[model samples]
Target: MPVSEKTADRLAQHITGGFAHPVFDAQAIFRAVMDAMARPGTVQPVKLLAQPPQPLSPVAAAIALTLCDHDTPLWLDPALRQTQAVASWLGFHTGAPLAGTPADAHFALVGDPAALIALENFAQGTQEYPDRSTTLILQVVSLSSGENLLLEGPGIERTALTAPSPLPRHFVEQWKQNRARFPRGVDLILAAPEGIACLPRTTRIRLSEG
Candidate 1:
């Protein structure tokens, strides 16, 4: 259906600024995201090139604008999906299709970490095509150094410690199950006002010792 002029104007009003230099900005953000994913639990700052809607953080907005496109199927959490302005702005800016279920989403945008659905609910690509698994972009309260969890994985030469902002109940237990999926699990990008952190499927996580 064709959007009315009034609706278009409203969507446009909330459409935040994208990369000043699309190529360069996207490359920079992509690199940052890649680096964070490579080194799990490390916090990295993503420059806010765009001003997204109310519930979307600068970091989360940057990720969506950088990674999402017509080919990607995005799923918004209830909080974000409830806002028509956010949906319209995303449609106008990214042209990414909205998925009806988590399993269908190539990317899932979650505004409230505590309210996020189970990791198992999303697509966990087949062993033959693990690259097709879903990637979650979660907006959290903060990302700072506090050393609440220990991380060990391919990227870290030794164990690394990190403290992500508060997460949903039973997150660690859920993570263990997600990790058990091996080559077929979802990856995560946790975005905060300060920066973003990654949790690739391969990373081994455990609560820190006293």
Candidate 2:
């Protein structure tokens, strides 16, 4: 049976009013995610209402709510199996298409950052429109603070602070290669239960050889 238009409108209104923050909670979430993406390996916090899947953290759910819409396609790692509750919530709230493959996704989620799949498996954007790439939302163990690594690039004045713990070797290497492509690389958002951070495509990241 076809769902009633009134029911649909009510559902839309409910989703729009989901955020507790005053006016445009999605906008605030976008700012938070952007800040984190511009500074790779940094941690930031977010507020989420739904109880995410076992491995999917609150920070991840917040990202889904803030950034995703009907236009975005989401790909979930195998570790995050279909949790009916979470799926229904996402379907109603964001209406983002659930992607079946990494390359077909605009936002690919890594429920367990430590067990993230090979970076090569995902899309790397095209030569013409490099910015047409994916954004990976990773859920990390804990936000590790105190580090010597200096972050410098867009959204960064001279330098910014980053955690000491290095990302997986493969992830780092793939990112370096992606950077060389310029404009044609994936963005990243590392989220912890406490905070969230963004590493946009334009950001330049280097390991402290010290």
Worst 10 residues of 2 by lDDT: 13-22
Off by over 4 Å in 1: 1-9, 145-147
TM-score for all models, in order of appearance = 0.92, 0.77
After superposition, candidate 2 runs with Cα above 4 Å error: 1-23, 38-45, 48-50, 82-84, 145-149, 164-166
Model 1, range 27-61, lDDT digits (tens) per residue? 88888899999988777887777777677777888
Q: Evaluate residue 99 in candidate 1 and report its C-alpha lDDT on the 0 to 100 scale.
A: 91
lDDT for model 2 comes to 0.68
Q: What's the residue-level lDDT of 106 in candidate 1?
A: 97
lDDT of each: 0.84, 0.68
Per-residue lDDT tens digits of candidate 2, residues 1-210?
998998886555445434566247777777877766655655556666435445566667777888888998888876674554455566677788888788888888776555667666677789897766888887766556424445678777677666633354455566677678776777777776667877776776665565
Pairing residues by index, what is the TM-score of model 1? 0.92
Looking at model 1, report the run of 10 residues with the lowest lDDT sum: 11-20
Residue 61 error for model 1, in Å? Answer: 0.6
